[model samples]
Target chain A: LAKTTQPISMDSYEGQEVNITCSHNNIATNDYITWYQQFPSQGPRFIIQGYKTKVTNEVASLFIPADRKSSTLSLPRVSLSDTAVYYCLVGVPSNDYKLSFGAGTTVTVRA
Target chain B: SAVISQKPSRDICQRGTSLTIQCQVDSQVTMMFWYRQQPGQSLTLIATANQGSEATYESGFVIDKFPISRPNLTFSTLTVSNMSPEDSSIYLCSVEDGARGTQYFGPGTRLLVL
Candidate 1:
């Protein structure tokens, strides 16, 4: 499993964009970068995932550099309800692979 | 995404007692996992519940401490034995959606040991 490092916390205002970056210097070639959002007392929800380049979804966008050593999760037009802990995991997506979660970045969306 | 449910959403248990948390998925899944989240801390993988065989536990976790059972594809249970105040945390279960290439988690079971 690859170790990941990210911000401890971030503050963003409503209607502003929030971007959280994660660095996995030892990321493997078979590993994929995935992001999950977790609300208070709730399970983590899948936000976006990408192997390389940029992948956009309705909820968020994932940008991966060619080196694949780092990835960014961009949340556009944030709202107060978007405040949550976001986790970035790097691993192979398979039934046998267990996800290792790091100290996630807590994004506080203020009004 | 799979609809996952856990039993006894929250419980307060006495020290030395044991609690079993049940996890059920709407559809069959090949993999199920148990995780523990302490207050103000990140989630930790407890074990991987394998059907028909013994579970594979992670480092710092043992089968005697955090026993897991996966009788079938859609259901699994995790037993916390010899509980203490240090064991108080939220226990969550997750299933892998191979088709979606992601995992979905259940509403965690909150346990408070007194």
Candidate 2:
């Protein structure tokens, strides 16, 4: 299984920064690091994806170094609504590529 | 960006009854995926629904329990058979992100078993 490891849960204050890191030591060459944000009672939404270095979008930014051993998701100036679970997955589908899911990091942005 | 939708936003069904969740994509897609997420848990890929072929289920999922159908490129359905309390989850459908090899999910269907 191409698994990922991250903190079980995290806490932050409103207008603060939140950074979640995921470690995938056994990631493959073709694997792409993708992050998703999931709220209560809702599905996971695509946040960002990066192969290496930094990839930024309107929602968040993903930083992946050359080693590819780990990646970080940065959410700037978070609000209470920004509280959600974040998942880091490595790899893409070609022939039933399995997405091994762990208990994602629950980020709570408190007021 | 693509828009994906799922039917039956929320449902409460008695045990032993079945529920079929529908997923529709605004545009044609190359690959579709089904996922199950329990309360306070991360998303689990239930199966990979391919157009014109059988659904490829994950390790713990069985086709008999979670039947998936991808009749075409733009739509798919997942049926939870012989439902139990364990079947209660947020069922979601996703499409492949062509450029980044990512998966974009729908709003999802929330199912609660009684």
Candidate 3:
């Protein structure tokens, strides 16, 4: 499993764009970079996933470079309800049964 | 996408008593997972339940403490055997939809062993 490092917490104002970047120095070739959002007392929800380049979904966007050593999760027009911990994971699609979650980056959107 | 559900949303039990947590998915999935969440901490993988075979447990977990059963692809159960104070935590189950590679999770069973 590729080790991931991220910020412990971040503060953002409502309607402002927020970007959380994760660093995985030893990312593998086949690893897919994925991000998840978890609210209080709730299960983690998949936000965005990408192998390389950029992936934009209705919820968020994932930006990955050619090296694929790091990825950024961008949340546009953040709202108060967007306050949650975000997790970044690096792994292949199959046989990687374990979903290793780190401390995660807690993003708090203030009014 | 799959909708997952778990029984016994929350329970308080005495030590040495076992609690069986159930996980049900609306559709049949090839891979089902069980996880434990300690208070104020990240989630940990407990085991993977595969249909027609024994479940594969992660390191630091064993059948004696966390016995899991998967009779079919749509459902599974994890029994906390000989529970202790250290075993108190939230138990969750998840299943992946192959087409989108998205994993859906249940509401989770919160167990408090005293």
lDDT of each: 0.93, 0.86, 0.89
Considering every candidate listed, which one attains the maximal TM-score? Answer: 1
Give the 10-residue window scoring lowest on summed lDDT in candidate 1 chain A.
A91-100
Chain B TM-score by candidate, in order shown: 0.97, 0.98, 0.96
What residue pairs clash in candidate 1, if any at all?
none
User: Ten consecutive residues with minimal summed lDDT in candidate 3 chain B?
Assistant: B96-105
Off by over 4 Å in 3: none
Report the TM-score measured on chain A for model 3: 0.97
* Tens digit per residue, CA lDDT, model 1, B1-114: 799999989999999999999999999887899999999889999998878889989899998998888999999999999999999999999988786567899989999999
Interface RMSD of each: 1.5, 2.4, 1.6
lDDT at B110 for candidate 1? 94
lDDT at B55 for candidate 2?
Answer: 86
Q: What digit string (tens of lDDT, one per residue) describes model 2 on residues A1-111?
A: 458999999999999989999999998887888888888767777788888999999989899989999999999999999999898888764434445667889999999
| CAPRI-style docking class of model 1 based on DockQ | medium
RMSD to the hidden true structure, all candidates: 0.9, 1.9, 1.2
Tell me the deviation in Å of residue A67 in model 3: 1.5
Which scores better on DockQ, 2 or 3? 3
Clashing pairs in 3: none
